[model samples]
Target: MDFARGTKLTIKYNGNVMEVTYISRDEDYLTVKLQNGYNITIPENKIDVLKSSEPQTVKKKRITLKHGNGTPISLITTGGTIVSAIDYETGAVHPSTDIRRIIDRYPYMEEKYTIAVREFDNILSENMQPEMWIKLAGVVKEELGKSHGVVVSHGTDTMSYTASALAFMFESLTGPVIMVGSQRSSDRPSSDSFGNMEGAMAFSSTNVGEICISMHSGTSDNSISLHRGTRTRKMHSTRRDAFRTVSGKPIAEFKNKNVDFLSEYKEKSDKISLSDKIEEAVSMVYFHPGLSGQDLEKLSEGKRAIIIMGTGLGHISQSLFPSVRKIMSMGTKVVMTTQCMAGRVNLNVYSTGRELKKIGVVSAGNMLPEVALTKAMYLLGNYPDEDFESMMNMNMRGEIMEREFLGDCY
Candidate 1:
């Protein structure tokens, strides 16, 4: 049977009958929107259509967005689920660069801030690279000159990594730089895009001058969290509250359209200082029980820096010591970070750690593995060789906490 878009239909599937709105159909399956606002694709041979009706013609008015009287805010879109929607004809979600479509969804944004948008890139976060981070830093610098703050829309998969890189690259910021992402696509019923974006905009107007991430504070839509970029990580695969601060508390929380500070944060500064240079010759290795010295050596070959996600208190198999020492002898820097979620690496406590440290394995004090990797990249790219080891252990951009609070761990 043929039906038009928005045609109401009753279908029987697996001994159950339900109503749905016809969206599109292909050779093998039919896609329809359920009452709860989720779209499900049912195999054509599995469902029996009991009744159908003609589509209704409903016109939507075009909303015109104008600059608001408030301070200027710049939005940079780097393609992600936050900027993606379902294509009914294909039943697939794709990235979009239509700034108007996004702004129209939240008209209040233009009503409160003079929003300026720039499409930095239209690629997923997994495709993000160091070169792109350099370019993005430049773009953000330019925008900061004209806007009170900037908001970045990014994919959740690698949002933490990009956020960490930016956190390290910008030594100082004139205004807050907020990175926001959603666990689900914008077209889905349960998408967190709006709340995250709202929180980002709200945070952008604050006196904070740090790189932070704005995401769902919990499963519900009541609150959004503002996490320091270097301390944040994507903890869950598909939950709205996927992103969390690993070893620290969020800087602030946004609820009921109001912002409240939870932790100390940097106030807005007079000028933006950025070190966009990044050494891309960096590799991150997760040490496991059976990883051979040969394998470790092969992975470390020709790399300027390597970040190892080691076991508790930062330990690799004793067998890999030879390879690590050899790598260091060749002028390579190997940094040790804990694979555990919420602890610092203390090389002085364990013989293995002390031995590793003796051979030049720097300890990353409570720094998340991803943050350590990005910090290594930033340090190697801009600093001198003599200062590399010192800078790695320093609490730069809040990546390395002098002490970890017991309550911070979940």
Candidate 2:
């Protein structure tokens, strides 16, 4: 029998009859996703494929609920694993685009906030770009005007970038713009979607006027950490608590449906503003051994800025100094940040660092490279004629940490 991709098959394997979703295979093994929600490889010769057919779709009963009186919030759904389901035909998880399943799981949300939801996009966050960032910022700004707060259901891969972009785009916010994502798909028992959504909504209802990400506080699902948008980064690939606030403290923590402030927040004013224009012609170069400036010459051709993730207090190999100087001559702004997550870029510490500064390489005080890139784009867009060297060194948001959090315990 001939079978194609997306075929549902009934097979006899090891003297037992079982049903599985046929994915693909190599020379010796067949890949299949079991009903147990895991992909496994079975020996092709050990299983007899007795039957194959297109799977039938079973419609689910939708649950409808009335709006609550607690606080008005908007749910902006961008495609992510949090709103994804197993595609049995392909044996891959894909975005469902239906957010009601997320809402139904959290019945308590109905009692606290009148939620207004919108499906903004349905693509994986890896495909996210500067255009999408601008569009999302527009949607968020528009939502914040009408709703008390907004919860953005996003994919974890690029959620930090989006959060940082939103932080720079929206200058004045009256309520929280909360971004949430999950490490596992919602169907998995270990999924962090429900807890994260709950925490995001809980924090959004508060008067915190900032852009933040709400995610699992730790490996367990007991609480969620609220990291400031510009300071957060995804540290691990598949951990529930992947995001951490780099060089700064989290603004708050949410537990048992309550937000406890970890630090002071700026007072919310009646005036709200947005600076959504972004300069996308920027590149982040990770400098390493044997890497020459010729490798980065093309990136500076039509770019407004280049952020270098340098090693050890922001020093690149001296071989790249000519390229760095050439980039400066081309009128491209150069900013240096540490590949080290916890420390500041001290170009004044070494002779090479001082020479780079003389060549107009600006140091990013303790900002993550990711945050530095977005912040550079923001500054270039909004203040093109102004001095970026001064602005880059200045602490615009909580992205720059004044001192070590734990007092050099490391």
Candidate 3:
């Protein structure tokens, strides 16, 4: 009762050392906000403060509390533009672990969900790697067992790649495993961080169970679209609605503090599975005019699988056929996915494609090149005995489009 709000103190309780912000208290108990964005009420007799509030370093601190009878959602943080801020001293924007600030700016979000923040990584998404993906999978796997759902806040640069990877690594996930990001940082007035985060929390509490993305649906804050993890892509650099669902409509949309399911989704199940295995000896090459067979040869060397973002219809020049043949002869898997975003890759439709297939290259159908790469790694790591060619073309997690289309489409 003597402590005031915003008081910084070091407290030891339940065998855990935590730096907390002292909030108000009731007649019987005292409430404190933990460093990791959790609010817990404890008996007054249990309080043990090692330090008290001082004005020398006083600054704004956030206090968060769980909503009564609210759904429990794990907020896993991976460094991205969404949680980044410009370090005026360094003149560069860097990922910040101060996630409580974001929640503080949007206090209304805590009213709907009992949020628990977990820091998985604090680096830019561009720095994401296979090992990080494996670690993230393990963390998500553990969290899903205890929480109602999990929401990952990641950077937009490689957010889709991580989302696609998680879609395959975690099979038969029942609860909503949604990834959310901000196109703009929180410091700006026009930031999309608030809407995207709000939408993700809303979607996470729903019955729909799948790995998905919740982001801006349009330029305005009208709605946030929920896209299947495998079918989503960041289509623009600066737009709030940068991510678009490829070859399919968004599975659901969040608006007016509600999630409206637009398409049928995997319902929440009692079981969840995870596979952290990944073969990192895979690479991708984007085909362009005047690319050499020597380049292809070198790219395939010491690689288990190579994904080619080939030209239209998934064709490569006949000049590179010899190098491709040699690579496959050495037991390297060559998979082809088109640079074009919307259509299925057909090796039999073109002369160049037919020639490439004659040697050993396999088509990735309508899978995004990034998805193809991750799937290749996943298959090579987990199901090494299975036929990868068949698996690549199969509809696993809705990565491939059922019907092929021509021209520009979203």
Candidate 4:
């Protein structure tokens, strides 16, 4: 392949026209940005070069095919920093669709596992909707049922949110369903994409499950940590390793080309089942100093559960406390989660906490309030008649801690 950065070229396939103005030749994939404003990674071998109209500066392209154990790895694209490539015009990065190219560039990953890369969509994790999750669920069902493990490339901002959603959707999911993303764009030299993907793929081939996050355990390439989706949180804005599992220990680790487990994971089962009936609809609202109750009106139409991302220690103003009471009394189950990224939600710490709890706000206890908000909808959708109190408070797929202190007392 003679393709290089700034080389003007075009590609076509089944109605999808891809023009290459900028090319990032990564170790595993050839990242090309289409003139149409989206980025697609074409494995170097997949380049059906239409033509080179301008001068081309050929950069060395490294492609390798290495295999690990005979694990079937499925890389599902759900839009995230991990799969996005560099933009030549503004230098901004966009969602990527070429997993095979990544695999080829980093042959060490492909050699250890047979990988499948498919793009479901190119939206940031925060932009993800339940309908998208439903679609992703179908894609995951198809892959995990046949593949040894699966990796979902998602945007870091909403990576934890989707992971939490999948944890609730997957009933007894066996094997690893890893969601990997990069806090820093992969265009940067210290980007965490490859390492995160490697960790995720390694875990997917193993027995880890529910939905887990494969990200920098620390701020380096030396190690990657696997935190359960429902338990993990993105704790930084610019750091390569930002996702962390608060209150709970990690599910596993990836270091030095090996998968090590700190805890056991969900295993493969005999009978497989699929359900598409989802009826739950919930919303997440951040509680601010001058918060209004109109947002609760969206949930007020019917029996809706709302999760309020409250201030420190789960405190909401006494003004919203009445609205909280109103929502609870209106048959909408509202839960409370701390805005603090770390520590648990303590409803008994202050009178405000006690007042909200008294008004029937379920304590989310650092469960990444958005996950609680989303899960509420999923369960409500599935079991329309079930009590929201039990479902919201109950530890479904390890989303909630058993008590305030489930670890060392000190």
Model 4, residue 82: distance off in Å is: 2.1
| Full-model lDDT, candidate 2 | 0.82
Q: Rate residue 37 of model 1 by lDDT.
A: 74
Across 1-410, the per-residue lDDT of candidate 3 in tens digits comes to 56755677788787777787776578978777777767778997876777887424333222234666677888787888675666443234555545566568666665666777676766778999999999998888877776788889998989889999998998778689889999887878999997898888888888776789999999999999999888888899999999988877889999887789887677877788788799999999999999999999898889999999999899888888888988998889999999986877898987898888888788898899999999999999988534888888788887887754342354
RMSD of 1: 7.6
Cα-lDDT of candidate 3: 0.82
Instruction: Write down the worst ten-residue block by lDDT for model 1.
Output: 57-66
Clashing pairs in 1: none
Tens digits of lDDT, candidate 2, 127-226: 9999899998888888888788988989999888889888888878888889999998777899898889888988888888889999998899888999
- Give lDDT for model 4: 0.72
Runs off by more than 4 Å, candidate 4: 1-69, 86-101, 273-280, 292-303, 348-351, 403-410
lDDT of 4 by residue, 143-237 (tens): 78767777888888877877887888887665678888887766678778888887887888775557888888887799999998887777778
Query: Which is the better candidate, 2 or 4, if ranked by lDDT?
Result: 2
Off by over 4 Å in 3: 1-64, 84-107, 404-410
Which model, 1 or 3, shows the larger lDDT? 1
- The collision pairs in model 2 are none
RMSD of 3: 12.2
Q: Mind giving the per-residue lDDT tens digits that candidate 1 earns over 1-410?
A: 56776788899989999988888788888889886778898898999999997765434222223566877888888888786666564344555545566568767666688777777876878999989999999999998998899999999999999999999999899999999999986667998998898899899999999999999999999999999999998988999999888767899999988999999998989999999899999999999989999999899998999999999999998989989989999999999998898888999998999999898899988999999999999999999988988999898888877666666454
List the candidates' TM-scores in order. 0.82, 0.82, 0.81, 0.76
